[model samples]
Target chain A: MGELLLMKGNEAIGEAAIRAGCQAYFAYPITPQNELGEYLARRMPEESRVFLQAESEVAAINMVYGAAGAGARAMTSSSSPGISLKQEGISYIAAAELPCVIVNMVRGGPGLGSIQPAQSDYFQATKGGGHGDYRLIVFGPSTIQELVDLTGLAFELADKYRNPVMILGDGALGQMMEPVEFPAMDEVTLPLKPWATTGMKGRPQNVINSLHLDPEDLDRHNAHLQEKYRAIARQEVRYELENQDADYFLVAYGTTARVARNAMHKAQGEGHRVGLIRPVTLWPFPDAAFAKVLDRARAFLTVEMSAGQMVEDVRLAVNGRAPVHFYGRTGGVIPSQQEIYEALIKIIQGGEKA
Target chain B: MTILVGAFGSGKTEIALNLALRMAAEGNVSLVDLDVVTPYFRSRDQKEALARHGVRVITPEPRVAQADLPSIPSGMEKVLGSEEGKVIIDVGGDTMGARVLGSLRRLLPRRHSLLFVVNPFRPFTATVEKTVTELRRIEDTVHLRVTGLIANSNLGPRTTWETLLTGHEKVLAAGRQLKLPVIFGTYPCFLNGNGVRSNLDLPLMPLQLFMFPP
Candidate 1:
């Protein structure tokens, strides 16, 4: 068994990335996730791996693209605004179909918002933060341990689909501390990247490019990308359902899901029928979760730390089979368990008016 | 006055918060949140809860309370200078974080006990040598001598008696080298009244207060 240790979410992500055979790491330091860079800055050199604090977020992301294109397991991390600056490079990385990991420890943001935690980047992470029809496999972990586990898995998934994978966490997850046991370092087995642009020896040159000037070629490439995305959606949907027999459901992800679960238990204690659906994989959206509760769901409440970004996806998933309601706290304020339980009470009492 | 300082994620904020709450039972108490490193997970986040216990929390102005800039709250000197209450100051983590203390060194009360919290589970403070090195670095940065050691070795929810016992030994050895007393080992309050006890001849503090994400 691996040794169990207490770690902050940011530090755990750094340890996981190193264990997953990440050869090159580049990043611009942003708080909430600053410790990740600090941890890597000290550990990467000790492991004889690469860790570079790039000049800017844009520069860091492009460095990841360059490193990943050259067949290295590459990664970069940033908070919300910094992540916004890397959109063009992320788009290119997705279009080029290179494997890389990007971590967005989202903070309050429409601009240079507050440094507190928020889930306002749901649209950016799942719907594609950059241009084009490409999608990144996004994991929304609620705990520090989950942050560690998902980070290692993000690397493997990124390579499997030959596309980018993002660990979409907010500052709460990044700053919080929890106990976690990491898989043994020897257990990490990396998939070979045969198409990587390593110098050709006895084989043909593996030329990697995102630009297809010919519209027909671009169309075909996009179709190929779409097929890969469809395969991922089918095979990689992950979620957790609690209190399935309850008549009302609360759908949430990340730390917000933790709050929903607390409220769910409180309502259950009061003889109210309440359940929780926590989507672990944000991109796949866990649409199947609704199938398990739709028959009895009085109303579906989507809770987030945003102005209801993920709620839109919840509404689409519900397809009007039941009323989809949203409860949220934006600008880095997290909704309390009492507030959520109250929301559930109103919905149960008002019969959809609430 | 009690000043808690340590490496980042070494449980300084949680320990400081709980200590202040515990001290509130004795008399007038004021908890000053002087952590300017990160905006989240500090004692200031629990201002409301602390106030409910009659503990005054001093933090940055309301306008920039959540800002990441290093702006210390005004009237800190007054709070430090006050003689009516026991002041518990929760400083930020690491030598870099302790840099904020440089500006407050002149205002620190001569009677204050600056305690260095050490969690053997954290990276920099994992060994006796590293613990001493890290503690010295913070002391050097702040220009204040740490008078005591707080052996707060834990792995959050994963803490076991074995983990705590073994970590206590490392911190104890570091204490011996530093010529400082290991004040007490802190444990999670959730584990209180569970028949768990430390066999070592060391005091133990049950920490019930924490700044959970809101």
Candidate 2:
């Protein structure tokens, strides 16, 4: 029988990957997450799984790429800079349309930003961490629940769509301890990866490549990706929230969302009508869902650790129907519920019109 | 150079391992174990092993640093003069073990780095000032300036984000008083003793496991 254990967001992601039937894992050591690697390194060996503590994040990501091409459940993880090194490979994986999961336990950014909890990577994860016309099915885990749940979803969606899925987290989620339950997956096996690189000796070879020398072929590939993206956009938008009897909505995700939820309750008891609308799938953007809620009556505020990155998304979602407002503090700093509620109340009462 | 300090069962080894691996990423680095007091997961335990990644662990030559007592080793003075590469020094838990560094004042680097691995939720959190005073006193005696802090606060497997945040504020302010940077922070994981470390990147050092039950 599989055992139940308490884990941080990082460790949960590692365990979830294992349960998703991923046997090959590679990564370099980074903060807030060494426990994840060490846990897997120590345990996987007993299961006869492949776990390599590569030289660098770069090496680790490429190792995942190689394994994914073989049609296996493969994954890698890193923080800001380390993830930066792996972006080139991430884009390549997307271009090839290969299935894999990339976990980014986000920290502060823009060149060695302080390693603290931050949601600044919202854009990086949803808009494609690296360069290219691609999008990662990004899932922002606000609690250990999402860390385990979304991690499994990341693998499933990546395989279902033959694209990369990202588990966007922060230092808080990765470092903080929590009681978590891991479910068994033997009763629910994922479909076999017939598109793998497990070798094509006796049968027709399966080529996994992102390159196209011919202009027509490249155009066709681009068109195919566009069509697939559109399909994903239509079917994959996801979000979560507690629409309590409140006029003001708090938009946030990842660990910040949980903080916002607590902050909302505290604000509510103080006689403020505040609720939360947290995004679970950031890449799909959940535009329709949020836009539909624009009729709920009042200003919407985006609170984050970054300087109004995701607020732009909120603004785009609300369009002109409701006035979109924002407040943020970055570089490992988080705003308090009082601060968020104050901002929300200020926006609602400020009478600033769109 | 980096300095490691923390309490018993506070995740110092994890932090050291994270720091050592970070050093190994770029070029050559060294993890010198000054903790003759601890039983397992000492810098000495994994020093030679770091060579696999270009990091070299500095061991005491004359074995003066080999003593289990809370005293300084003669070899450290020699280490300060050499400008070979990055170095991480792991010290014992308290002022007693930290007292040994008084003799190695000439060895501590300037502006490069130093860290006081703090797990604030432990028995030390009774008073913020008390903890700060003790840490500062240790720094004063060691002659090593603490340039940064690594909050490895936890409540064993029951630790929560709130506990981490609560402890972080105190330790962070303490480190801030010395104008030291809080480079990154670490939290405890509930993985079985055999589970993986963690997946977040924050220029961190995870907890070290004691092999001999010290």
lDDT tens readout by residue for model 2, B1-214: 7777754334566677667777789877777667654422356656556667676666555444333344444467666656887777777665645665556656565645667777665433324675676577777767766666787766555666665566667667766575776777765444233342433333433444322110
lDDT of 1 by residue, A261-308 (tens): 999989999998888999999998899999888888889888999998
Full-model lDDT for every candidate: 0.88, 0.71
Candidate 2, residues A219-279: lDDT per residue as tens digits? 9998998898888889888887576446778888877786678777777787877778888
* Residue B41, model 2, lDDT: 39
What does the lDDT come to for candidate 1?
0.88
In model 1, the Cα lDDT at residue A200 comes to 89
Error of 2 at B121 (Å): 18
Q: What is the fnat of candidate 1?
A: 0.72
The best candidate by TM-score is 1
List, residue by residue over B171-209, the lDDT tens digit for candidate 1.
999999999999998777767546666678788877885
Kindly report which residue pairs in candidate 1 clash with one another. none
**lDDT for model 2:** 0.71
